[model samples]
Target: MKRKHTYKLILFSAFLAVVGCGNQEKKEVAQAPPPSIPIIQLTTKTVTGFKEYPTNIEGVINSDVRAKTAGYIQKVLVDEGQKVKKGQVLFKLETQALSEDAGAAKARVNVAQVEVDKLVPLVEKNIISSVQLETAKANLAQAKANYSSIAANIGYATIRSQVDGHVGRINFREGALISPNDATPLTTVSDIKQVYAFFSLNETEYLDFLEHAEGKSLEEKLSNYAEVNLILANGSLYSEKGQIQTSSGQINQNTGTVSFRAVFDNPNQLLTNGNSGKIQIPTVYENHIVIPQEATFEQQGNIMVFKLQEGNKITTAMIEVKAAIDHLYVVESGLQKGDKIVMSGVGKLRNDMAITPQEVPFEKAVKPIAKLFRN
Candidate 1:
């Protein structure tokens, strides 16, 4: 009877211990805290997507100054970067040899004229035949032509500016032998009152532009195109906007790109030939849903965002991104305007994970990119 009572007591104690462990496990599960995360309600707004292409800048007129005649440069009238007017002499070549040749030719011309005069009187008296007088006249004409040709060569010794613009580098200085056949020009002149920014788009991009751009003809489409912004080399936006000037109209077989040119007024002469930057062309999206890029993630080649359900449970919602600009994504579909999405901490959140709801303003979620939509 004593053994039976001890066995019963031991069984009772083991049963109580099992019951106590089960109750403790239940309490720990109940007290566990849900993850806290910020959420934002989506809104419909106008969003603009921008595509930037590298650009090469040039002045309205870039003229290369070259020597018209072969001679040694006697004087350089203007320095590089000097503002010059049309017909202004920029260089003077050594013409002493040309001058001597001209003198000799003139003497020949005078001697020919005297012979023609003497021959005309002799032919009138029949002292010489008419053919001899004709021959003398022809010699006079040839000598006179030689004199005019030498005079023209002397005139070419002065190099002048063909247009009113700023001078570029002086490749040849005083005493430098220059000729028309020289590979390099004496200088370059650029008219920077207006400048052109040349850029290119790939074949696919050009086709897309042509499809979405408004108007029936290419000219009309370009005319109706929106003004583009320029990002300078130093990462600053230009104050004035530029207009689409022209395009190559054909794709380059080698580069597979269609070239485009945009014109901008440069009253201050700030932009010059060889300047480089980027051309930002904006495509405006009206009444479209946009979201912060940070709020989304890529899964299995698809972009997704976490959305909060009724029980504060987050679920992965697949979103189609039409375009991404800066830090924002232009959402095409898969998200409604009133739906709430996780503002951040997306990487930490899992599908169907319960979270403590911390609502935040939509502007606060995407404040970094607020300026991109402004007109």
Candidate 2:
């Protein structure tokens, strides 16, 4: 019985030793140092915002080249993309039939003139009545008019450019029958020294644009508007600036949008008719509070950040974002200048959590991340 009591006492003492070691480990863990976290002070930054819309580019003057008289195309003098001046012939039509008719008309005019000459002499000699002379003179005038008409048509058989521009595709090559009544033009002449970009704004956008401009009249508002930039199809910005204009304020019934035009100089011929691109309009914010997007997390669809407090503890801040500039958010409200916030590791943090605050420069923390998506 004494041996049994001795064994029980030994087992109880061993259990106490294990419990005391665990208590010592618990106290050490509870007294350990807090985690170090990088923090940044909030600052306002100047940011530019852009609104982009798809646009259709066209030459300021897109003239269609068409034949005035019906005939087979005899010659195409110029090639596609050939630069030509006004009055230069583009295509020649087969005029053999018209020339033959013109020769007959000329002969008739000569015959009428001979008859009028004979009648004049006979009238002077009192052998013919004055009414007969008048009748013969009328025939001569009619014949001359018919010959002139035929000659004018022969001239029109050679299609000439009415504008100084570059030639487009030769739709009807040599030997193709083309007429003035044909649906398609023989070619198109585009004056691309200056280009026009056309875009549209919906009803709400149109009203908002006009409402923001500081002018009583639409003309004044457009004149006071800021210059717009073009984003080429290749995603590069065009080198030239453009001015906006609108002829009518009336919205289209079919499209339900207001049309806007921007004119740009194309000295290098980078832009041409049928080209496509985007128009970018800018709105500038002078000074606004900004925070790195990494510093914020979404909670219940609201953007949130951890703001540092006096006790080395952080509290959740719900920021009102004005615009998202790259990887940063422009704060509209909720966060003010001089407020310090956690710079990183927000995913591991909770509200009112204590941390060893490590100060980080405001620009140093955001610039590199912000530059990743900049234009």
Q: Backbone clashes per model, in order?
A: 0, 0
Which window of ten consecutive residues has the lowest lDDT sum in model 2? 366-375
lDDT of 1 by residue, 159-248 (tens): 899999999889989899999999999999999998999999999999998998899988988999999999999988988899997888
What local lDDT score does residue 218 receive in model 1, on the 0 to 100 scale? 86
Tens-digit lDDT track for model 2 on 263-315?
A: 99999998988889999987777789888888999999999999999899999
What lDDT is reached at residue 116 by model 1?
A: 92
Score each candidate by Cα lDDT: 0.92, 0.91
**Model 2 quality (TM-score):** 0.92
Off by over 4 Å in 1: 1-22, 31-33, 369-375
RMSD to the hidden true structure, all candidates: 3.5, 2.4
lDDT for model 2, on a 0 to 1 scale?
0.91
Q: Candidate 2, residue 141: CA error in Å?
A: 2.1
Q: Which candidate's lDDT is highest?
A: 1
Backbone clashes in model 2, listed as residue pairs:
none
